[model samples]
Target: MKKIVSKKDIAHLDQRFRANFINSIEGFKALNLVGTIHSNGGTNLAPFNSIFHIGANPPLIGMVSRPDTVDRHTLENIRSTGQFTLNHVNETIYRKAHQSAARYDTNVSEFKAVGLNEQFINGFSAPFVQESKLKMGLELREIKTVELNGTYIIIGEIIHIEMATNKISEDGFVDIQQLGTITVAGLDAYYKTSLLERLPYAKPLM
Candidate 1:
């Protein structure tokens, strides 16, 4: 028989253990490094897997941020300057991207500490990961606070996009498999992705 964990049992589990278990249960998540720059010019890079699309007409994306329980440089910088960049985690820079998750000091620049190059685009206040094959710049649109868990959900409008020409298909799909993008399971395990299959649009009576 397979093991089962009840809510009561899980409630009694160790804090970190419960976090790891719940995080991994969601399966593979897209790994991305969010880049931000403070007004003082300190840069921050943090890897987050919670980025999700909210709409296409406006090209909006939403990302979950843990409540201001700690000094989160990414969130603070985004609030200060209202801009940030999202960079896909590739196989070659997975290690460096993960390093950004560490709690670096407020004035510290993770790009400098982790050995990743920071790139700035015209008219943008945030920096992008130079080594990332796919990157996008965003301007903060709104912030929603989840009262239940004290989590913050920040929504941004896509302002700029950068990618290699060969990585995109004629139909507008980015071939992530060919891009060597990496996904994450739990908090530490990193993985490369492959296409399982591309299915046609579903029909009511297909």
Candidate 2:
């Protein structure tokens, strides 16, 4: 027997669903993206999850920050210095990454609170996490304000990248399972990654 999914039925399903669909969709993929930014006066700040690399042509990366109902440290720091760093979260320092997300006053430094080492590179004013398995410093390129939303999307041009020896592939592919990367779920939970088969790109008839 054949069945068709009516538009009314689809809409009903959304209302009927008990669990938060978004939470399940996003976290199940599993990879927490951590970021570190330096303040104007040489303060090192660390925050975790919800960052992704967009392009390599001009070396671009994107970050989404929730708007400041309280104090916007990350957004304020980036706005002030126009620079930030992205640190990929791994198993060795998962606890530190989690700590970075804690609520703190504008004067408090997340980096110092978590006991992570901050590294400064020449030619870039932003500080990066020295203890991170992989980290990169970027110069702010663009900032787009979302419509009717409290958050902001930030874009940066990658100026420098540091990585551990064993994790990087010969072709430069970052293997999550090899690095033991930790991922986030429901805005707070963390988990390790597992290996799945690599598949080829899909093609359609011409």
Candidate 3:
């Protein structure tokens, strides 16, 4: 049976409930996942659910950063080094990734604390996580700030990409779901993924 949503249902709820409801409807199961911002100077900060790929040709990738009431280590590291790696979390580092979201002092390196092995290119000092099922190394491309909210969106050009050899198909598609990629639930919950169906692109009528 389908349950109908009526305005009266929300009207009776408290302000917090209403706000959370709106957030839940919009952002629930938002392909949310965690990634490590591998910074130069051997500093790696784990952050949750901030990954997005912007384009294909230039292979642009992006992530967002809100104001750090504490200290924004990821933002600062990227600004200084001009490079960062996005390491998608899997079953292995799930718990560690959540712990990284805490307001830790900038001096602490979450990478070491979390037991993530590091891989780095010689020219770039920022290290990439070897354990991630998928990872990308990006060079800083563009950054835009939302003036009203003071949040920043950082876009980078992908210079290198790495994936677990087993996850790629002979046809060249990355079977992320088959590889058991993780996703975010709400602010802190993590969920395993399952496939629903595949849809083809629409064709134009002659």
Candidate 4:
């Protein structure tokens, strides 16, 4: 039997329940740890599941920053330094990545708090997760506000990429599954993925 959750039912649902319900409905999400550093050199790391590909020509990426009603160190650091990193969360580091989401004092570096090592590449100001199998350094491009909900959409241009050469296929597809990258459902559930099959591009039948 199918269960129906009407509009009114959702409106009346408990806050935590509603959050879980809505978040899970979006299915699996890409999980990454965003790394940034404040002007004073205080580093910040936070896990985000909302990262998405914006375009390829410019190698753009986008992620959502929840409303700034409260202190958002990751967002603030990115804004201040105009640079950040996205580190893929894999099985070995997912637990530490998840812990990065906890709210800590502005002076605390989540990298140290969660026991993750920070790595810096030449000419990049932001830190990267040393344990991450795949990482990207990005420069902030734009921030758009969603007035309806007050969340901000942060967009960045990819400037540097670090990954294992074996993980890439001849055609440029990255085998994330082989890299052990994991995904998240709702706010807490973590999942590993498998590739079922690869199909050719679709075309109209003659």
The estimated TM-scores of all candidates read 0.95, 0.77, 0.78, 0.96
Ranking by lDDT: 4, 1, 2, 3
lDDT per residue for candidate 4 within 1-206, as digits (tens), equals 99998999999999989999999999999999999999998888999989999999999999999865222788898998999999999999999988888878888899999999999999999999999999999999999998898899999999999985565777889888888899999999999988899988899999
Candidate 2 on 1-206: residue-level lDDT in tens? 97675667655676425234445456543343334454446465645455677999998878777775322667777888888877767788778877776786666677777887767888777667777767778888998888776678889898887777556555767775565566777555677867677665689868
Off by over 4 Å in 2: 1-21, 29-42, 69-71, 166-171
Model 1 score (lDDT): 0.88
Q: Which candidate number maximizes lDDT?
A: 4
Q: How accurate is candidate 4 locally (lDDT)?
A: 0.91
**Number of colliding residue pairs in model 4:** 0
Better of 2 and 3 by TM-score: 3
**Candidate 1 C-alpha error for residue 15, in Å:** 0.4
Give the clashing pairs for model 1. none
Over 30-127, each residue of candidate 1 has an lDDT whose tens digit, in order, gives: 88999999898888899989989899979999998985532267888889999999999999999998888887778778899899999999999899
After superposition, the stretches of candidate 1 with alpha carbons farther than 4 Å from their true spots are 68-71
lDDT of 3 at 56: 88
Instruction: List per-prediction Cα lDDT, in the order shown.
Output: 0.88, 0.68, 0.67, 0.91
- RMSD from true fold, candidate 4: 1.3
Candidate 4: TM-score? 0.96
Q: What ranges in model 4 sit over 4 Å off?
A: 68-71
The C-alpha local distance difference test score for the whole of candidate 3 amounts to 0.67
Model 1 lDDT, residue 199, Cα:
79
